[model samples]
Target: MTDDRCFRIDEMDLDELRDRTRDQTLIDAFSNWIRNFAPHVDEVIAEISAAFANNKLRDGIGLFEATGLDDYASDEELRRLRASDEKLDWKRISTADLSRCYCSPSFFDPQGFVFHLPAFLIAELNDEHPYGFIDRIYRTEEHPEGWRALLTNKQRVAIIAVLELIREHPDYQHELDDIDASLERFRGAQSMG
Candidate 1:
């Protein structure tokens, strides 16, 4: 005997279904990320903070200040930002703002295997905010860091970037057309767990 019960899949708006799914996947991805990162974030921030205090996190990369690109900076204004001797002071935000919040242009490894993360971002991770955070690389490595998680480093970057683009320039077109396929990847991982 078989009993069939029909029910709604979700209360989400169909038009925004993909976006909602993508956000859910990223949020889920954060579950394990926060576990590993929560304890270390503070230590990382302390190191970076100490460096800043010592005037070590100085100078911009090329023409870009250590601040990287500002969320509010328009494309034309960004184009004007280039490498030069004139250093732009690091754009420092309060711990509350960075905690459980997303920050752009973050590097994974600043001093070899060591990293400096903003205290604010670390706070958010410890709190496990719904939207989560972004990981920026100040420098690239020839090898992978080997994070054996559902989302790879690049995947996390793409997902976070898409969300940021949606937040910063909702009207602008982006190259995130294949998000559904990516969502399936996350969905698969979730089911396994």
Candidate 2:
């Protein structure tokens, strides 16, 4: 009789053969293989978005309130002051985790993901910073996979509200071109003041 141990490959069930060999090591190996082949591009996109959002908030406020001029000032002077405030300091804030101050599922990715931004960072960005601040985080985009920002749409609107307030402030003014520059100037002014 033929030896049962030396079974023919064609006689085995492919599904059963695959299932019998599965384990943590195999799973890990597959994950590593996939990661190596398809590195996380979403990470880079999220980082860029984070930097952009942070800068936007900082500069928007700075430009709106840089002139040191108030309601009593002339329109031309207000325009110039706004232009000056448009410069901001992009590097002044760090991307720390801030999950404690405010908790909302909106900040989570629709696909179910996680991220953290420190409350101190948010406070510093919106409260302590010159010009004005956004007390909440803003989420700009989402992916089908799993990735999330510390901010959400509602939070972004809240920030925009603060920006609008800064714009309407008797001493405030806003300009588009000077937005980036204003953040830089404000960072410097904040450091000095």
The best candidate in terms of lDDT:
1
Clashes of each: 13, 24
lDDT of 2 by residue, 1-193 (tens): 1112111112233234346666655444333433442232233324434544433333232322322232345778756655653233434433321222123223223221112222223333233322122222222222312322233443333333333323322122334223334334334444443
Tens digit per residue, CA lDDT, model 1, 1-193: 0011001112232224444456664444333333443334445445434443322233223223223353455655554543321232332434443332233324222321122233333333334322333222211221124221423343344333333322222221232343333444434544554
Predict model 2's lDDT versus the native: 0.32
lDDT of each: 0.32, 0.32
Candidate 1's TM-score: 0.25
- Tell me the spans in candidate 1 whose CA falls farther than 4 Å from its real position: 1-48, 55-76, 79-91, 95-103, 106-116, 119-121, 125-193
Q: In terms of TM-score, which candidate is strongest?
A: 1
